[model samples]
Target: MFCSLVFCSLCFWHLLVFGNSDTVKTVSVSVTDGDTITLQNNDSQLQDNYLLSWTFERPESRIAEINKGARNFLIHDGVPDGRFRDRLKLDNQTGSLTIMNTRTTDSGLYEMTIKSKKDDTYRFTVAVYAYLIAPVISSDSSRCFSPLSPCSLVCSSVNLGHATLSWYKGISVLSSISVSDLSNTLSLPLEVEYQDKNTYSCVLNNPISNKTTHLNTTQFCHTCAVDSSEGHANCCDSVEAVLRLVVTALMGVAAATAMFF
Candidate 1:
């Protein structure tokens, strides 16, 4: 009988450490700022006498709890630095926790514990990224010597968080640059012919969202017709001279017709 009790104690200790590993689950979630995210308990339903608790960052910092036996559902968001105050919601049925208006500071580890006849734990690693901004496209006219010269264009954006800035020609990427700083200015350069016909775009993106800006070559790079006599003259000047001559001829014709009438 004594040997049997010792064997039972050893078995219980082994199960306590090893068996509990299977009951724990971990998940990784990514979300954008000002968005809401829910961490599920993985429990389809809760019993009448179950206890559920949630902690953030560390185990000792309890942020939420639910006690069905005591008929209590409490959110302790005010305890841990008040970062989650008025932003946390708890589901009474599934014991899932939801965070509203999530910010970048909320990116961290969260844990959930459920106790009844069995113990179940859930871990979530949440990453909240800032909203992305559209990139701006500009041309460097100093690099252009003639109308046929390649235009040097730059794509730039203010990085609110970790993001990648890329230039794409159609669907293929031409070049890219990445920044991990919280606040920075990122720029990517691309050169193309003034008359080249191709779809181009600049994109700024993060793990959660992306923004794009289409390139309009005609708006930035002005095409001028070659004047053989004057070497190199702006086409706009020739067009304006023709328009003035036409206006002068039309005025003379109108004056002659008025005199005849």
Candidate 2:
């Protein structure tokens, strides 16, 4: 009887351990604001008597659920906050959850549980980023006057979410700047020769998306038109000519005074 009781206890322990064993998986999802994002459970066909549940941020707050046995579908969008009101969806056939018009506030951990003959759990870490605008390339007006000096260019954009502004020469990165705050203006400066021939571009990017603007050296960098007679294109040429004339005049006056003396 003692041996039998020990055997029964061991069997009970094994049942407790193996009976509740379920597959759990964690996935990362990233989406842009105002876009729809779906978290899949890989269950194409759910059992006739199945229970699927989803919770957001914390496990206590249930966001959505589907029960095939009860023939019911529920969305607890009003639990955590009204931020998810009317934006949550669930697929009864595949047991997938989709959020429409996702916002940055909706970014957090989402947990899904499916209970049937086989139990499975899925955890998703969702991140929603604001749409990124293309960086604008403009030449600094103060630095554009001198044709002999390096041309100063600025790449600017309105910061959206966590974004980085980068200047690239061909495929290699020349320099980069980033800001974590949103709606602020971000600018990165790059200096290049007026006659630069290498390809360069400015890019604004986040983890999931990027926008690029190519640098047009001729469009942004302006050199003074060459004088047809002088065959030179420089803003300082006229000043240099004036200085030469003044020196020559000074020399002539000195020579005349010496002759008179």
Highest lDDT model number:
1
lDDT of 1 by residue, 133-217 (tens): 7999997553322444577789998856889999999999999999888778898998888668999999999987899999998
Clashing pairs in 2: none
Taking the candidates one at a time, how many backbone clashes does each contain?
0, 0
lDDT of each: 0.79, 0.78
RMSD (Cα, Å) of model 1: 14.2
User: Could you give the C-alpha RMSD of every candidate to the true structure, in order shown?
Assistant: 14.2, 11.2
Q: What's the distance in Å from true for residue 39, model 1?
A: 1.5
Residue lDDT tens for model 2, 1-261? 011111122222121123457777676667788888777755557779988899988889898899999889988888697889998777778777778888888889998888888887777777888788899999755333344567778999985788999999999999998887776788899998867799999999999899999998888787655577887544543544566589999999999999989
Q: What TM-score quantifies how close candidate 1 is to the native fold?
A: 0.72
Measured by TM-score, the strongest candidate is: 2
Displacement of residue 69 (Cα, Å) in model 2 is 3.0
